[model samples]
Target: MDSQSAQLPIKIARIGSTVMNDFLKIPVRTEETSATALPRGAAITISGSWKGSITISSSDELSRRIAAAMFRKDDNSVEARDIADALSELTNIIAGNIKAILPGPSQLSLPMTLETVPEAAQGAVRVQLQDDQAGQLLICVQPGLH
Candidate 1:
């Protein structure tokens, strides 16, 4: 059995909580996990789903709020870089968390730039926080020879 397949749930909870509090300025309540196909917008597309992704974006403008929270000195000016950095951090943290749970010999590939605009699509399981904004995390598995 693949190591990642076994520990996916635990990793999601850890990463989801950290990002929600640190970046989203909210608490993570709900959690979900599943296997699925990679969306066309994704940068890395392997045969089947060779990669996994965890998205932690909030439509409530909380991301803007997070920018403010991160840089205490800059409340009036939150640059696009700040938001992008936060997003990148989110991806890293989620990936790391998942990596921690995976069995030895399995490695997590680095995150690549996702050029497409991210839409608010439902994940395998969408977790809605108390702030009314929901966070979706998806983990995709690569094709394995049966």
Candidate 2:
């Protein structure tokens, strides 16, 4: 790894907590075990002087809660598109913060909603988090152009 790629510095738990707390008003705690690939999720990629990607996967309940929070409605009342939009926005916010501090000129791609996370690429870092109301959410960060 070169010095530039070393900027792949990440604080997954802190980032997750702040983003989730601020965006959804839901606090999260980190767990020792990594979170599994969830049925509902989102992923984004960034490339340039410093390159990497972040993938977020969550429990169905959490998905609903997130959508509910965004739409100001009950979890069951939220539509699938609402849930997808919420996840996409959350992923973008988290990735944008990361891209900002990195050795640019970095281009952060649009967030992509996923039915399930694909296999982890080589050199990926996965962090698991648990929320009191929503259960577990996973953050997988890949820290290099590769």
Candidate 3:
């Protein structure tokens, strides 16, 4: 793990773990969960009401590719647009579930594409999941920053 990831707040960590456990049913080791790859890694940040960013990264490109493919539409069967839409819907459901646990009236915006950047950016708080094959769930609260 790097210095930045090590400094994540406990509250966010707890929320991340809870999201994975309750929503995704994925159990992870907290120590290993926070470790992120250096370069050519994937870090996703979902910032909105329930504040904290969660990153799921791996050195393996195959994993990411598979995830992309599975979530995309093909000519033979499902439409690529539909797959993308489904993923966004799933993100909303998970975020709503997480919001129920938090204190206050914060709403989650629908999950949008993070886009491909030259390098992954450092988010407010880092949340790395247990399974690399598993997509991440992050909801970073910015308070009254809106």
Candidate 4:
């Protein structure tokens, strides 16, 4: 692993906390999880000297909660667009933060939601977190193929 790669987990945790706590206004407790089995969710790729991608996954219930929080809508009234926008924005924000600390000169792709985790995500560093009100959140950082 590259030196920067070793710092991934720490970067992820710090950025995740900042994004959730400050931007999302939600506090979370995160733990390492199996990198292989991320739940269905959205991802955004970053390409540069250090190429990799960031993915955000959560349960449907939790997604709805996030959507509500993001859009300032009631959970019961959250729309699909709200869910998609929230997840995409969350991934984008986290990826942007990570890019800053990583060996840079990188560019981020638009976020995309996937029904199944991508093959590129294999061997990714994964972290899982839960919020009392938002349910569960999974974050994965995968290095790109050289």
Candidate 5:
């Protein structure tokens, strides 16, 4: 990994802990692991001097768990919109934090949730964070393709 890529996990852990408080744990970079199939998630693109995207993804179960924590709802009570909105906000916040550390003068596009992982995310740097009770959070950072 390049120097910038190597620094991402530390920023992610710090930002996620500060933003999510007790709801999120420190994220760990998952190396030498097969890709987890993410059928649902969210992404935010960063453009300008550096262009790329930051995606936060996971299984439906984890999505709902994150939504519950974000919305203060019971896990069983999270709605589809809740999941989508929570994921979108989470992705946006992560991307924003990353943008601050990266060579900037960049712009962050509005966040969007996906029902399936995008093909462009292949080969991105990925990290995984586990919740205390149950669920996993996968964060992918893909530098822009010039």
Candidate 6:
């Protein structure tokens, strides 16, 4: 495993906390749980000095809340596509930060919003976050060249 992979959990947690807080205006903290809502979020591939991908799987409630905050709308009025876009934006910010810290020549692909992570990524290391005031969001980091 590359050095970056070894420290992925901490890096992801820090990145996620900052990104979600900034964009969604919510506090995000690491927590453990196997339960996640159906239909996840985005996939961002990493290459060069280290290779892998990051995926954010979030609960429906969490998605709507984020979307609502991002667009300055009520949660009940948030659209499905907007929720996906919010997830994409969140993934982009966190992934961008992660890419910046990796050994150079490292390249980050554009965010690909996904309803479900591919089977291969199901086995990846994950960092789960809890928003005490809202729902859950999980960040999965698959280690390997894609």
lDDT of each: 0.46, 0.79, 0.42, 0.78, 0.73, 0.79
- Against the true structure, what is each candidate's TM-score? 0.53, 0.85, 0.43, 0.85, 0.80, 0.84
Error of 5 at 22 (Å): 4.5
lDDT of 5: 0.73
Candidate 3 lDDT for residue 16: 56
Cα miss at 80, model 4 (Å)?
1.9
lDDT tens per residue, model 3, 7-61: 4345455765665456544454344354444222222223444454323332333
Weakest ten-residue segment in model 6 by summed lDDT: 115-124
Once superposed on the true structure, which residue ranges of model 6 sit more than 4 Å away at CA?
Answer: 1-6, 34-38, 119-123
Q: How would you encode candidate 1's per-residue C-alpha lDDT over 74-119 as one tens digit per residue?
A: 6458776665565555556555664454434444544554545344
In lDDT terms, how accurate is model 6? 0.79
Q: Model 2, stretches more than 4 Å misplaced?
A: 1-10, 144-146
For residues 7-116, write the lDDT of model 6, one tens digit per residue.
86788788888888886788888886663534668889999886988777787788888889888999899988898898888888887887787667788888998956
Which ranges of candidate 1 are over 4 A from the true structure? 1-7, 22-25, 31-51, 73-75, 117-146
Candidate 3 stretches with Cα past 4 Å from truth are 1-83, 117-123, 132-144
lDDT for model 2 comes to 0.79
Candidate 5 lDDT, tens digit per residue, 52-119?
Answer: 88888876777787788788888898999998998898888778887898777999999998878874
TM-score-best of 2 and 3: 2
Candidate 2 worst ten-residue window by lDDT: 3-12
RMSD in order of candidates:
6.5, 2.8, 7.3, 2.4, 3.1, 2.6
